[model samples]
Target: MNDLVCLLFQSHVKMITPMLLKLFIFASVYQECHGEERVDQPDPHIAEFEGRSVTLQCKYKTTSPQPELFWYIQKENHFPKYMLKRNKYGGEDNDAQFQERFDSNVSSDSVPLTIKNLHVSDSAVYYCVLQPTVTGNTRTLH
Candidate 1:
């Protein structure tokens, strides 16, 4: 009876060893690739007059499982202000201060932020940020 029980336990461990190894490999690869997102915003020095509109171009490349896009603005000495973001769930958030003057458009590989009726106080740097969208873990043990 003792030998039979020992044999069963050994078989159980052997069956699970391969699955555990595969899960570990998948987790590491997922972590490494999820951070592979890059955004490009050219025309670092853009100038415009008061009451005029300015559109900043931003393009991004995402090679992760799930990705979300966002836009932010940073003033001279202030922290980045969350202007707007489009989540994976199709929800959108537009800042109250930028309701009428600020607008954003998202395409397949591009998302540009546009400001209308520009004011002197709006002289600041804008940034395009992309992040990984998290859904519930889909991994299941067979």
Candidate 2:
């Protein structure tokens, strides 16, 4: 009777071991798949005439207490260039080349890019990024 009882216990342990391992792997994958930060650019395409002013909208969600937002511009056949950065704590930095016309203000849920005196050369793809970002695929306009 004792032998039978021992065999049953061993079988139960063997069955549960694999199940526990699978559960652990799943939890790790789930944690990695979900993130606490995201950014949205509602208007994928925007058009404005030369010398006109335009505001590009960017909305973001983050769990961070002090969120920092960034703007990047990618012209045709070139790498993405950093345009500016704005923090929730009233800090800001703008690249020298873009200082004259490019500006943004970080609000509670958004940081909009305002371009004054738009030029033909200003035509390009824009990106809004959040700090501590996750790696993912992004599409660029061709």
Using lDDT as the measure, the top candidate is 2
Q: Which stretches of candidate 2 lie over 4 Å from their true place?
A: 1-32, 132-142
lDDT (C-alpha) at residue 2 in model 1: 13
**Candidate 1 residue pairs that clash:** none
Give the Cα error of residue 60 in candidate 2, in Å: 0.1
Task: Report the C-alpha displacement of residue 54, candidate 2, in angstroms.
Answer: 0.3
lDDT of 1 by residue, 29-111 (tens): 75466645666776566777777777878777776455677887666555556888764456677988778888777776777
lDDT of 2 by residue, 62-124 (tens): 777778899987665665679999998899999999999999999989999998877778877
Task: Please give the RMSD to the true structure for each candidate, in Å.
Answer: 21.5, 23.0
Candidate 2 TM-score versus the reference? 0.70
Error at 70, model 2, angstroms: 0.4
Model 1: number of backbone collisions: 0
TM-score, cand. 1 vs. native: 0.65
